[model samples]
Target: MTFEREFFYDEVRDGFYIPGIIKRFWAYELTILSEIDRICKKYNIPYYADGGTLLGAVRDGQFIAWDDDIDIMMLRKDYNRFAQIAQKELPEELSFNSLEVNQDCEELAASVGKQVVGFAAELLRKYHEYPYAGSVDIFIVDELEKDPEVEEHRSLLLRRILFLIEAIEKHGKSKAVLKEINEIEKIMKIQFDQRTALKPQLRRVMDKIFQEFNGREGDQLAIMQFYAFLGNCKYPRSALDKSKWTPFCGMQLPIPEDYDAVLRAEYGDYHKKVKGGGGHGYPCLKKYENKLKTLMKGTWDPDYHFSEEDLVRPKIQNFRDIAISMAEAFKLSHKQLFEDCLKGDISTCISRLSRMQEEAIAFGTAIEQKKGEGTESVRVLEEYCDALYQAYNALSDLTALKEDGIEKQKQTEEICRSTDISSGLQKELEKIANTLLYYPEKLQTALKKDFKRQVVFLPHSMKYFESIRPIVDAVLKAEDMECKIIPIPYFDKYGDGSPKEMHYEGDAFPKEYKITDYRTYDFASELPDCIVINSSYDEFNQVWSVAPSFYSKEMKKYTNKLIYIPWFVTDEINPHAKEDEKAFINMEYYVTVPGLFHSDLTIVQSEEMKKAYLAKIEEFAGKDVAKKMEKKIAGAGSCLLGEKEGEGIQNVVDCFRLFLEK
Candidate 1:
């Protein structure tokens, strides 16, 4: 089957744009997904979209805008059965890669199906004009013992074995690496001949560890070897025991029966549209694009020998390259450390910081060891090292305070236990310690000083602009807040892949409001503190749609908060009244659209309207999500009605001020 999708350049994450090449890469991945779906149907092997792919399916009804790969999981038993028959069932264009199928493969997880051969090659050439191979990552969900301690031990052993496998592949079975592997194997109680390939040997040990708890009765299951250290990766066995079909792209794909619980467990606030780059860097096909093209042309050699430098780089590189690498590593590590801290994973944060310290020291020593470097270069390197150390010291202090906070929380719990307070009162005290003391203090410590937060307004049309004008005016007058009104372009989408015509509604906006040109304003770099949007239909609107780049989900990544202000206000409709209930039910199409679903906060016209919106959301998203949306959906009173009545405008202003302060 031919898989062709329209490709477009858009901002996929904050400061990260998806080039046309990445879109083509996504098309390649979609082809692989389709093939997998076909084989699974034919064989009756079960699979559910895993990780980011599942998040995308549930949230966007397709691939995550920034994601570069598709991930699916099968139970260990089903996975083994699929692995046995996938190659035979798959079309000529696709080839499944696993240790059993390709022993040289170094991946800990098996099954990178669809390597862009035969039909897939011709399809890409015909549609995308670029023949690039893409694969669906197949993860195995293995059963875990109910005991937390035993599960933890298994996870640790699996991680160590996986690490050694990676080290062997990268360092070529060096004595140091092999020594580490030997120790891990002894602990795993698996031994192998010295002449056997180190990579496959370690993988076998991992497989043994993974299968140890399989077939035994257990209530927990985990996606093996992928983020195994994360406490939330394990799930209740019931979460995946049954499956239901959900619309993904254009196909119905199996999802966990308890998808909501699974998503919530994996991502604390799964509904919130927070855009960030995936583990693999942006434009994931860059390294393989040329190689695939050459392979398609029959010039690529399958078994090319590597030069000495290719096998392993020198211990010390040129000063410039070393400095750049160190800086990049520090940035990535620092970002990850803060993310772990925010997730309340203090141990992971500390462990990452310790690794960063070691890396910093190594870099500093390498700089010192470099010979014939100019005095100026030496001075700069020394200065850089000093700054790095100072930053590390500050982070160390912050982590210590976080640890102290945890101690204080534990002490508070103990005090409550010792007292005559009711259980409810004890719970209240614990909550106070966590919300009022711990999180706020940690955030305060990390807050940067003397920076003006950017608040951007993206109003697609003149009518929508009027809906949010009051809030925009309030933000402009607020001190220490920078406001930019960037009116975006929309389109009249035909049912086909292309739009009928592009519309620039910004031209109709009042001339008094400062409008930044959509072409010039950089959403990624500005990284607005808050992004206010009036339109949210995205591609769902057949008549009039905002450009894909301006979708609320896309904007959510560039800003800390994506605030949605409804373009129209309705009179209060009491759900209790039959006529009003019917009216409210009919309004579901407007109330439960993507814009509101993806927004961080949505301000409705009045308290009555907020209830109406919540009722519709509950009907579709379930009661639990509706409960969470209570905080997200606010009643600010209509800006349009407020202006006409000339009284409730202050309420709108007050609401905007409260959100901005947070």
Candidate 2:
């Protein structure tokens, strides 16, 4: 099978065509195999090309250019040896992941994994992880008994595995394993001791199978993961123990000495070509992982770039000019805001960010009306500038959410993902994936957009939403922001899974936003940038339920986070609030700790009020819970402002401006 041309790998690009994703996947594949080959040669430990990779070598001489996966195997002893040293042996780019090496995932699988046979561990790129890029599968082979009884047992296991695969195909990988337990319970008619969905009771069963097959002295051997698929994957030990070199993608690599025998047994027609035998790679969407990375790193050029002219453009002839001024404002405020975030000065950060959003909204309106929707450059610039402001707010709010002195690096890890163990690079990749999933096409214009900072102002009702609009607008005035203020219905957030809903007439809602009525269902399609829960007087008075006690698990779907804002001021304990006929009895007069606890950041009346809330938290939740809650409680205005009535409103407005100026 010689050709006129030699498909030799190049020094710089290997055999890959530059800028092609599939080529890149192949390049990484060869890099891993070459590294593995070096280690095996250097250590004098043997491994042979197994499965499709070997088939590719004997059949194609080069990689089946379409094939994206690489497979190799070692005998149990060699496999153990590689496992012991593969981390140090392989390039740092390659990371080892197997049930034995990654006990965390192994145990996770054992407890929650579906009824599966032993899993084949893999070596993957460190940052890429699974299903995102090319990875190597290392099959570990053990001697198998070629007996009728053993064959029947293997067949039964195969049926269960078939069921497992179907379950995953129907449901998903995450839920497939859990449902396996249920299927087993129904079919087997036996209740296993392990009860929790997250528990791994199959470890013992798998271990018994491993021990049973491993102890048997037989002529046949098989990779444990594929025992059901490949019955008695037996060959003379010399075929692998003794190896031969063959040309694979222009490199001479070891395949089993009796490669034909192995291939014939595995593929039947080893010399034939199949049209369906195309190489598959991970879901290509993650290739755009860098799209978000670039965006977050502030690499993407927004439609409007900020310049000094923005500040000088007095009359603001165009939206791009407006963007320039806004960008400059952000540039000045960003440093101060970042420093404040590090100090957990979230009160100041939130205030400034809120103001920035308001200014952006005003500018956006000018552009929308003057230039109209065709002013995409203006709109995009507005959105991106808003995102930059929101990103800062998110990070600052994140600091407040964390324990004091936690490094910003650690803070990013927490902010980027829910689980603490998630890697930094992994988090960024996930952030991109999440952003793509969370926002609809209309809202995804700016990759720099920080959904975390985009806030949903969920007013208790139309009346409450209307009442706060004045204050919200006052803060937003002159600030470059595009945050939307959407109103929600008033009801017991904590009630039967579906809470009862009520409505009132004659309340004009905020402009440019649809009122999310509590009708047939909650809004399902759109996710909020941020959910700010306003604990207004109308809210407490309208319902007998207190703010602290009124929480709906459903609201988490809208946004997993919420920021609580104290709109009502009270000096007494257990202030009974009444709206119209409905009265909320036994509501805490001094503070709304229950509602505040839900907020990543709680905006209170003043520093003195923060202290009062801390005291209340300590009294009600004890010292441990209070310590966690103290940082979140920050006051933006004085409690005495409420006593002065109209003076209070002015003071609140002044306070917002003061924060923005700083």
Candidate 3:
């Protein structure tokens, strides 16, 4: 199967590419989620999707293409209970790995839930390290504890210092996951005078904070390990109390009730534009070499418990290189950035973070378009992953620094006052967030028939263009919205027509269209912002509906909604057949069967027309298609604004408006 640009888009590929790898992983993910849903529903265990999993559920109602992990959050109590019951309840192939079992862990798992990331990690784990690798990543959310009016500023400072100390200590302890990374940070010869002594104090602060705020439900909640500053993240308490079921990877999953506020707090604007789709910042999929065998057996992990010796360092180091390399470009150092954040130098800290953000995006785009997961591609992926990790950490630490800005100045003669990247950084994140809204999915079904512009595909024979012009004109005239009519003349059948016979209705589809070697396949890119094909009404195929020769699959690449209008109302227009060639030919049967299966919305001339099409579908396709076709197919006589002509193109135009008004 050829690679698809997207993980899941159901249609006739213009160039015949099938996304087998992503599709297989998609199947595996759905199975695990479905099982989890079964258990959760049985117990009424409340969990809202967290991280990229939540992003996927909301953004496109599916997993972001490169995202491999399924992250979900639970209140501490619910998480504890689910973990206990899940061990035996989950099948052998599925494991519930948490901090207790896998000790070399830094995943403030609230408790590590599941790591539904696909092939690479699982297969590599057979030859490698890291313990918290399940199908789901679980994090804990605790209601904030209120006691002694917790000094948010002091606690915030303590948290940053503690995190920095821990990070610095771990710096040289673990081998740089990449060869280049091992050498890159040599310049950041970071040193801390009180590191050893400070760690003991850091523990005390952490313990004291958690002890004091352990049980109280003050106002906000804590999502990570830092319990001292109970209210720093300040997620609304109401976000977790209730949830609504949202579609995710083709399954309905629970999401926080107050998702808007939650997403804004976490991602600024969660729906910005970005390349390669979004999720927890890594596409953990492996090429589907064994996809068929796995799919047939229906298992995500054939060997859930594999080896534990090899290193994913080479894998993870590349990202470290990308982050620090990009940081150096802006003359900023990650070590310095973190150190500045510790001393409350918010200005320099954010400046470095801003650069990190840029590197992360550009680096991520390069990874997404990589031709294969070769050594270089893996390095890019690791860099992309690490950059995101570092960037998010920077943002989190920045929040902490701002919280403690007032006191840090008095303690140490450092820059004072809270600071924020309210300008370019905010804009940068917003732009990237909006870019993520348009990821690919299984199918682009138009749940409703709607269009901003109608690109009417004319027949190879230019004569039909003038005849249908009035109907197109009437439809444009009827709608209140702006309309651009593009009359694209193409060979309407299996093989016929020269592109040279073009008649332009507007500048959109020029009269003397240049690309004269026109084939239906060539029009995919030039399609308007929105369009639809009438299943039976198109000028495709022979005049009669019996022969499928006059077919137009030109609209297959259209990501927008496809609308259907009844083809030449033969019975109504000319009932007397076989006697007059004009009567019979013009009134020939319109075969809608070609377009019936693809309809997002189907419009008909009358209620009887809807029934006739439904019955025909039932006879050919089956009762299932007929039943669904019945609901999607509609007949309104006409929804046009102008006076109705019982037998003109006006009726078809009116049908076009039915979906829009709907």
Candidate 4:
């Protein structure tokens, strides 16, 4: 179970260095792969390296530098036999996670059509100092219709069904959700209970559909777990009917005899190197190391141990500490204020005093609950509060004197210098006030509950309008929702600040949906509940940049929520694969743009893409910001898919509602 192989940094490819940590991760995964190979061989079962793992073996003769996991596929029959015995056959150090062996893995099991039997080293912590434990993803390849059109039809049907199953699990069996499920069942000529564990029943139906073409002649093969758009999942039966052994990470591994065909089908130009980590991110093993450590220690909790209300007392103490600092500063300024007006320009002092007054008012409102308690701290705070009010009046009087004339200005300056206000007092008071105002309880209570929520869609160009259209349509369908489609202007950047050309596509919106002119829309005054913008790149876009006014940071001031949805879609990439990483890096300009970094939430096309966006964001913006952005990035399947297939629209709508509810 222990990996004896010592790892070190080495240049596996030109200019691509595999660090010791990643090398160790690869060794850990290879151990699991070797164990799987042993079990398959003992049981006389057949499996072949799939996806990025296969690509790496054939193209690189080892694990891809950026790839962090191993993937292997088995035909449906072999997969079933292996699943039946893998748990008992695996060594004590290794454990298999699947629906049959562990119900906790049911979601993952259902997502991948049948089961994704993840083999992990249970004694990893006991054996290794590094907390990370890598796994081998076991996928089941199912048979599909031979004809391309029929195969597409079957794939689409299964995709829609899977989407509904996910929706049912996420949103519960809402009436609309159930209706969509029923429509799919009717098409398949099947029936299931409308209530009482619909998810499991839908999963059973999917299983039935997956095996429909099994045991039939002239059937094509496909991995049904991934999105159909991935393009590389489908293959000819002959692709895997024959097998050959290949060197992978210094170990001989099983690969399809027609690996060229399989790799080509999955990744065109398989020999090319691209650098990007998998959905789990670069060095994906460490992504969940902490969570696993907690679980292993039996310290993980499924619920919050403390609530926001519980933080109120601690926040009050924090505010008091800040108040104490401000009060000490006031003690020094108090004598000077009585003797003279202030030391600086009357206008600047007036501005600071005004801000101090606002902070005092806000702090007073925040501490209203403690007013009747008659605490000693409260009594002292009241005294300083009064003094702060008087300071504001004194500054106002100096402003009035300055407006009088030059002689008045000289007198004001003398008065100010004699007063000598403590410059830091204003900052301290503002800090204290903000701490109180942003208390979890205060923020929770301040949430707006409007009768009708307004969401404004700002699409910069007609070409990418479809990206936000599904969300717009979903919002309009809601009884309590209203929206405006405001197509903003953009310019072709010409290296200089000046634009090469200005383009406005407001008129390009479909006649059915009214388009509001950006000039006419009062963003600051209207205060839309949510502002959805499709454009992410601002000034960084080389070819085109949206008008600065529509940038996420600026629009945030005018809306309660700012949502950024990508204007483009991409095929699924192996997050751990170096080749995929390279592709993602090429897209860094668009993926890590300001809109994504600044927005309250970003809706990506799929979970795989979300990982890419997050990894790149972390790489560019740093881990702290990426961690915060994690909750903000959601993978609601792309609307472009629905547009192309004329389905999955409801699924996309349901995903939007799910994220918006949060």
Candidate 5:
């Protein structure tokens, strides 16, 4: 069957187009991301994120929720390498098209290289009507030459070549994909010959060579070996400083050294005048807006031009003819014929729509003629207006289908909703569980068994404790693990019961709440194989000193088996009545804030965080603790903690694959 003509309708508006454009855009972006990732992995090309992609990762740890585009850059060399491999390495449905290599230049130039974009095929097919949708830009950067004259020429040449290649590739691929395949092999041969002839005009030849060998069984394998050769050309991380990039709301993009001058030359005072449509629901380019105004004023009419009168005056004449024809064609249903005529043809529809205008004009003419006092013809015209009204509505619907953004949004939401869960809260919880549950099934199994591995969970509140009971019970049932949550007292009230007691009933009863004997409930003596602690002042102080010391005396009881889990009062749990669960106290290792507490080892998000944690340990517990922590943390890297050792603890928290905000 052909592609479905289903339209995404807005339930609220009783029409199609606008509600979830952002969501559709994001989904498309993610698909692109996966395609990029797959291509990069196959080629073994290390390309650092550029433009919006990198900014989103470094600043927000994710993509901007509303962004519809994905821009990534690779070094000129890697880009060339990727181009060489794109044909064979990329999927048939998803291949890269570049300016330098592709055969079609004229078409590419016309569409501004959109047709040659790696992600264009899917985008064009998916959102054929979306005006703002364009191809993914693969910017290639080269090392700046030291000699001024040579540098300038090289830069200019590079830019010129890039533009030319982009145009060529765009047109080439468009032709290749959309071409009639009367003889596939013959066409392929002709295409290759044309490409070879155009090779010298393009910048990179090796890329084209790679494209030649791209075959069904051998593409990625060939690309991988090719990439391995160029791996050494990668630049050091210090070459790009993220802070130097240009800011865009919450994101930033790497700018040329003379960014301000470049921007001014390209589009002066870009910041002074908004470059995009922010207030409008759909993204209307500033250029489009100017064109629209001009189009409306008729000073510079577009190719497919139509003025109000030009459109209506002719339609009125056509409608009058159609009305007379309908009266003769089907005498029994003159009204129905007139009604159907409006929805049938725009030219005729317009005429039928202008009847009222014609009547008004006639009345004015008659009034000028001094016959306005008696208007039987106008009265008769007024009675026949009902058919015209229906025609007008039908035409309006057709016009609206073209302009409404909500239609695409509705379609996208419908597609996504049918395929995946859309509840924001449910998605969040799943993200959290997926992120937090290390070794997922294993963790679930561990929770299910009766291993009764004593877990020291830092006190959040009674409700939190109740919520975690399932997580803990699941782990125990899976692996016979038993967890004991460490109760911490509120800092404001010293006379209150121990934090642990708050989880139990009867907190209001003085006897039930009081910590009668601290020695009897010695956490150190009762320390199980594993300890889960929260990152709290009292817990940090105790785990860093009191618990470790008192617990050390009984360390021989269970030598090395502590697992620290940093948790928070997840949205799934009771959040209003209690604070979040921050630390997990195990018998051996305690996971707390990377910089705040000294546990056996720590879990961090990035290599940066891992370094930060090590540095913090060195500061708090001396170089020995830092070194030891580093070794221990390094040893446990296989666990799915989702971070390096020294990165920011909060980064890890944020990355926890959980729903962070509502």
Candidate 6:
């Protein structure tokens, strides 16, 4: 069977992106910008190239070649003056794309200005179907007052204007492309006739429509600032204090001097060489050596647009914004607790509070099972429960108790309260403080021992889930072990329908997001005796928890196995054990086979990868089991796909096919 495939760009009638168009369009954008700057300087208009365009220029002395738009800002007063000058001075081919009268044309224009002319030229030349346009964006920057209330009012108005323009652009008002062009021509004609020397004041007024639209209530200014900082700069890790004074786009934009230190804390080495590419013709710029290329695909192009339908789009919400949203959502949900009035409802709240408290106690029990505090996050959770209980009880009793009321109210209060309002809730809070507490530890213990006996190799995404039947059949056939190979739903992230099913796909992922050294390992405990993890430079310690001390301690505690597998490491250079490293720790006994070929019973994915891995094992283990196992490996080393020695060998596909063939 043959598969019919096509590149992503092929699907679009006139894909806005076509590789080289970025650079060419950027050059034209820059040239137009230079002209703007020249005119601004002559008239003393305070302006600065801002946002993504500014970021690209300052960071690398070039445009963010992947980005498809350019942004520049002018003081609101200067912007008003420049609007007048733009109409009279700009060449016929070049003009300001107002966010008003010609919103559609302006949207099209902004989209074009962001594209590199050369890249667009190449696409037009090659495919002869790509659309072309020319444009630039002018952001009017008003001096925001220090007061949040005033800033909020102004921001609401600005956002409303933006929404109207976007709506007009996305859903064209005209019926046809020709009709839209004619509309633009009429607008320009009206503007030209109104002015004697052609000042853009009329067009500028047309851009700002003060219509009667209810203003949205939210911290719009803060939201705008957050995105501006996140999308435009390499933010400092901690407080972002340094970002306040640093230069942006050749202007003294705000940034703190200690910004470099904060950046290093989060993205270590801030200047590492990084390899980049993801399907497209050119390599995208990367700040770190192993920055995920997968997440970066198609985000910078003009044509590849994804919708942001939610009122608060997660795709764009910054860390602070997320926190605020979460807090609000939680508050709103909590209001349901107070919406009803009854002694019974209060009891329900008491039960919930009790459960949370019980969970906290259980956490303590689990900590005792482990050698030490497993993770700091667990400890913080324990503290959160304690605080929550204190708050809940105080509130519950103050409202529930009614000493001044008659006998009936007094009896109801005593059931949930102690002698006083505070003590009653406090006693209840103490009783049920330890529910799902050490569950993770129990899971860890089970994983190390009982779970290791049965293991299955799972892809990031599962295609043929039923394919696991043969493997189960083989295991049962070999060891009299009646088992199952669970088929997990795989999300085919790379175009295909490959599922990304992993045993720990849901709850097991770290609750809090952080860049740390602890790595998470997956593979259901009951499925296998041990798991082989793939690693990268600094990511291994953080992403998979493969440190020698952690591995050995875990191995000793549960008698269940937590094996270390190294990829990209060779046996010859530091084979067996390096003198400086711990004996049990350095590369031996961890049982790693290269991803490609394993001379041992291990199956490698490719001949080339196998050859490289085998050479290293031979150099280190010398004439040991690694060598003996190499010869025993049957049917080309490529068959294993890096499965352990003595285990069954089957192609990823063959594993599924065997059940059918049977």
All-Cα superposition RMSD per candidate: 30.3, 31.6, 37.7, 23.4, 37.9, 30.9
Tens-digit lDDT track of model 1 for 1-662: 34433343322232123434455556557667778888888888889988888998888777775566788888989988889988888776568887667766766567654454333435645434334556788878888887878878888877777677677768986888878967876775767677767777667667667778888869888876754656665678899989988887667778898988778877879887544424333344544645654655864422212122211212222234335445556666666755554444434554675676576556546545643333333444354445445544544443443456878656544554465645544443333223222322222222221124667898877766878888888777877677899988877533222465787877777777888899998776566677888775665442346888998668776665778887766556665665344345435435556677667788877887788788877776778767877888888886877755444878877887788677
lDDT of 1 at 48: 93
Expressed as tens digits, the lDDT of each residue in 3-83 for candidate 2 is 111122111122211212333344446666777778778887788888778887887765653344677888776766776
In candidate 4, how many Å is residue 475 off?
68
Give the number of the best model, judged by TM-score. Answer: 1
Clashes of 1: 1
List residue ranges in candidate 6 displaced over 4 A.
1-18, 99-131, 153-662
lDDT of 3 by residue, 1-662 (tens): 12222233211121111222234444555555666667778788888887767777888786654355577778777876787787677655566666444433434453323353333445322311111233556767766545434546446644664555466467633343223223323422433233344343334343334334545666677664534534333477876778999866546789998887777666666787222223222334432323423554653322111111110111112222343344344233444554564445545555665665575456445544432233343344345445545555645543453457767544433223332434443434433333322211100111012213434433333333343444555655654333433334332111111111223323343354322333343334334333444334333221111112323333434424455544223222212222222222221124233454454566655666566556555555567756766877766553321244453345656555655455
The TM-score of candidate 2 is 0.35
Per-prediction TM-score to the true structure, in the order listed:
0.44, 0.35, 0.34, 0.43, 0.25, 0.26
Best by lDDT: 1
Compare candidates 5 and 6 on TM-score and give the better one.
6
| lDDT tens digits by residue: candidate 4, 9-52 | 22224434343445545665776777788888999999999888
Quantify all predictions' global Cα lDDT against the true fold. Answer: 0.65, 0.48, 0.45, 0.62, 0.35, 0.35
Encode model 6's per-residue lDDT on 1-662: one tens digit a residue: 11111121101011111232233334345556656766676786665445545554445543443354566654345566776676556544455655432423433112112222222444333322222344567654322244556645644544443444444457644355335334444644532332231123322433332211113422111113222223222222232222343332333333224535433433355454222222232222111112322334643222111111201111222222232333343344334333321223455555555654575566445544432455443454466566557746654664554567567456755655444434544444433232323433433443233212333332211222222333434554543222323222211111111122222232232333121222333322222332222221111111122223223222223222222222222222222323212211222222332221221133333443344345444544444534554643323322222364433335533432332222
- Backbone clashes per model, in order? 1, 19, 32, 15, 78, 68
What range of 10 consecutive residues in model 5 has the weakest lDDT sum? 579-588
